[model samples]
Target: AQSVTQLDSHVSVSEGTPVLLRCNYSSSYSPSLFWYVQHPNKGLQLLLKYTSAATLVKGINGFEAEFKKSETSFHLTKPSAHMSDAAEYFCVVSDPRASGSARQLTFGSGTQLTVLP
Candidate 1:
């Protein structure tokens, strides 16, 4: 079984400042981790993913995350925040081997990012 935990339920940041969203995971086996962002009523978009290639993973919209197995963490960060970046973010875990009725993806509760002008 695998699970994802987003440390912050909400995070507020001023425009042009750095942004950070913390996340952790627990999995019995190696898992694929991802960060997804939902802008208001828009659908979720893939931000970044880690599948054991590089520890540091970069994504669209200037966002990035580093997978740290020792810390069990995959924290998302951006050097600067934008008004358009205000949205709800989700951390997800997936077992590539799972299939056919078996549970695959586990999503974190979610973290709402508020960008203040």
Candidate 2:
């Protein structure tokens, strides 16, 4: 079984301030973790993924996250916020053991980020 929880339903920030979105996960297997960003009326884009290789992962749009096994958390962080960053973010988890024909992605409800002008 694989599941993810997003700590925040919404986040608001100024145009130049930092951005942070929290996520937690639990999986029966090692688990593949991912952070996806979705612009308004657009499909989700892969930001980064953790395949049990590295704990620290860097993603596009100046976003990054650290995988903490002890804490079971993968939190997204950005040094600065931009107006273009305003969108919905989803935390996803997948299990390779469950990746054959029955493969499916478990997504967090999502976090709506609002970048202030």
Candidate 3:
């Protein structure tokens, strides 16, 4: 079984400041991890993903995350916050080839980011 836990339900940051959103996961297998963002009244867009390729993954909008096996963490970080960056973020865990499994992607509760001007 694979699961994602978003450490924060809400994260607020001032425009031009740094932003951090934490996430943790537990999986029976190596697992594939992903970060997705959803704007208000919009669909979820994939921000970044870690698929056993590299420990450090970079995403759009200057966002990046380092996959830490020791800590089982994949925290998202942005060099600076922007007004457009305010949105809901999700941490997802999925095993595309699990035995007898549907290969479903499980999503976290979601982290709402508020950017203050």
- Listed per model in order, the count of residue pairs whose N, CA or C atoms clash below 3 Å is 0, 0, 0
Top TM-score hit? 2
Give per-residue CA lDDT, model 3, range 38-116, as digits (tens): 9999999999999999999999989999899989999999999999999999999988566555768899999999999
Q: Model 3: which residue pairs collide?
A: none
Worst 10 residues of 1 by lDDT: 96-105
What's the best-to-worst order under TM-score?
2, 3, 1
Task: Give the alpha carbon lDDT tens digit for every residue of 1-117 in model 1.
Answer: 899999999999999999999999999887889999998779989999998889999999999999999999999999999999999999999986677588567999999999999
Q: How far in Å is the alpha carbon of 81 misplaced in model 3?
A: 0.5
Candidate 1 wrongly placed segments (more than 4 Å)? 99-103
TM-scores for all candidates: the values are 0.94, 0.95, 0.94
- List the pairs of residues colliding in candidate 1: none
Q: Between candidates 1 and 2, name the one with more favorable TM-score.
A: 2
Model 3: residue 72 alpha-carbon error in angstroms:
0.6
